[model samples]
Target: MSYPNPNPYGPPPGQQPGYGYPQQQPPSPYGAYPGGGMMPGAPAPYPTVMPGGVKAARVMLFVLAGLNLIGLIFAVMGLGSVSKASKNASEYTTSDAMTAMNVGKGLLIAVIVVIVLFIGAAIMLGAQFGNGGSGVRVGTIIFGVANTLVSLLSFPFGLVHTVLGILIIVFVSKDDGTAWFNRPRY
Candidate 1:
C-alpha cells in the first residue's frame, strides 16, 4: 500500500520522524525572547510612598482672600449699611462681624494704595515745578485735591480691610501643621 512521505522533502535514511528540527516560537516584534536571556516574570516598578494632601489649607486661604475682596467691593459701592449693620443689636438684622471686618479692611487698603499714589504723584509734580514747568502747576494742584478727597472718602473701607487682613493672618498662622493648613474643602 502507498504511504505518506516521512518528511515533506527527502530525508536521510537514518533520520527519525522529527529529529533535529528547531522548535517553533511565538512572534514578537519587541526584542524579548522567551528563555533565560531576559528575566521573563519580573514585576513593574511602583511608587514607595504616596503624596501628602495640602488642598484644604489652600482652599481656606483662597476663601479668606475672596472675603477680603468682597468686602472691598461693598465698601466701594457706597453702602452706608456696613456701619449701620455693624451697630445693630440683633444678630439676624446685623451684618456678620467677619464680613463687616473684611469690607472695612479692604477699604483701608484701597485708601493706603491711593495715598501712596498721591505721594508719588506729588513728588513728581513738585520736582517738575522746581524745574520751572509752570504749565502743569494747576493740573498738579487739581490732582492733589482730588486724591485727598478720594482718600478721605475711603477711610472707613480701609479700616475694615485692615481688620479682616489681620484676622486672616491670625487664623492662618494659628493652623501650623500640614494637615491643619491643607484642610479639605467641604
Candidate 2:
C-alpha cells in the first residue's frame, strides 16, 4: 500500500504541482509594493514617469502663455496710442474722429483683457501638468482648441500658435496622456 503523502496541500504523487488543482499565479516581477502589478481582475497601475506626449503638451501651454504675454504688451501700447489719438481728436471737435478713437480704444481693451485671461489660463494649466488630474487634461484640451480657433483669425502671424495648439491637442489626447492624468497621486 502507498504511504500517506506528507504534504496534503500539494499535488498527488506522480502528478505536477498544479495537475489536479487550480494553478497558483507567479509572484510579480515588479516586487510586492502597491502598483507593482495588477491583480487578476484589477486595473493596471499608472506609469511612474510622465509620458513624453504629456510633457510636450505642457511645453506647448507655456509657449502659448509666453506668446500671449507679448501680445498683451502690444495691445496695451496700442491702447495708449488710441488714447493719445482720442485726445488729439477732441481738440478738433470732429465727432467722426472721436467715434473712431472710442471704437479703437474699446477693441484694444477687449484684446488686452482676452490676452491676459489666456495667459493666466495657459500658465495655470501648464503648472498643473505634474500633478493635475483629468480635469486638467480637459482644461488643457479646451485651451488648445480655443487657441487654435483664435489663431485662425490672425492667419500667417498666428501660424506658430496654430501649430502649437494642434500639437498640444494631439499629444494630450493620446492614450499615454490619459494615463498620466489619471495616475494615482499617492
Candidate 3:
C-alpha cells in the first residue's frame, strides 16, 4: 500500500510526506520528541494555525461594533417617541394626560442619556482603532445619537444627522497612513 520515495525529497522510511502523512521534527525535553511529550512516535499538537483570518475577523468586529452603535441610537429614539406620544395625549392637560406625559418624558430622557453613553463608548473604541486622537468619532456619536433621538421624537430631519455621524466614523476609521493615537503620520 506504500511506495518508496526514490529521492531525498520524497517520503521517509515507513512514512509518506503527503496527504494523511505525518511530519517529523526534532526531539527535546518534557517528552520523547517534545511535540506531544510522548515517545519519539508522538504527534504534534494539530498545528497552532489561526482559526479565522485576521483581516476577516477585524472587519467583522468593526462591522458588529458599528451595528451595535446603530442599535443603541434606535433605542434612544424609542424613548423620545414615548415622550411625544405622551405629550400628544396631554393636549388638554388633564390629570391622566399630565401623568402620561411625565412618564413618557422621563422614559424618553433616560433612554436618550443611555444612548449617549453607548455612543460615547463606541466613539472611543473607534478612535482608538481608527484615526488619531484628532478623530471626531466621539463628537460624531454624540451628534448622531442626539439628532437621531430628537428627530425620531420630534421630526424626520434627524435622520440626516444620524447618517452624518455614521459617515464620519466609517470614513475616518478607514483612513490610513496615520499614527495610532495622535502621533506622527507614521
Per-candidate TM-score against the hidden true structure: 0.29, 0.77, 0.32
Which structure is stronger by TM-score: 1 or 2? 2
The residue-level lDDT of candidate 1 at 157 comes to 48
**Model 3, C-alpha of 149: deviation from truth (Å):** 23
> Highest TM-score among the candidates is held by which one?
2
Q: Which 10-residue span in candidate 3 carries the lowest summed lDDT? A: 46-55
lDDT of each: 0.43, 0.88, 0.50
Query: Residue by residue across 1-186, what tens digits does model 2's lDDT show?
Result: 999999998888878775776677666646566876654655456777888899889988998899889988999999999898777664657788788889999999988988999999999999999999999999999999999999999989999999999999999999989999998897
Task: Indicate the residue-level lDDT of 150 in model 3.
Answer: 49
RMSD of each: 24.2, 5.9, 14.4
Ranking by lDDT: 2, 3, 1
Model 1 clash number: 16
| Candidate 3 deviant stretches above 4 angstroms | 1-61, 90-97, 129-186
Model 1, 87-171: lDDT tens digits are 5547554456657656875675665465455445544543443232223334443553454355345477445434433433343
Q: How many clashing residue pairs, candidate 3?
A: 0
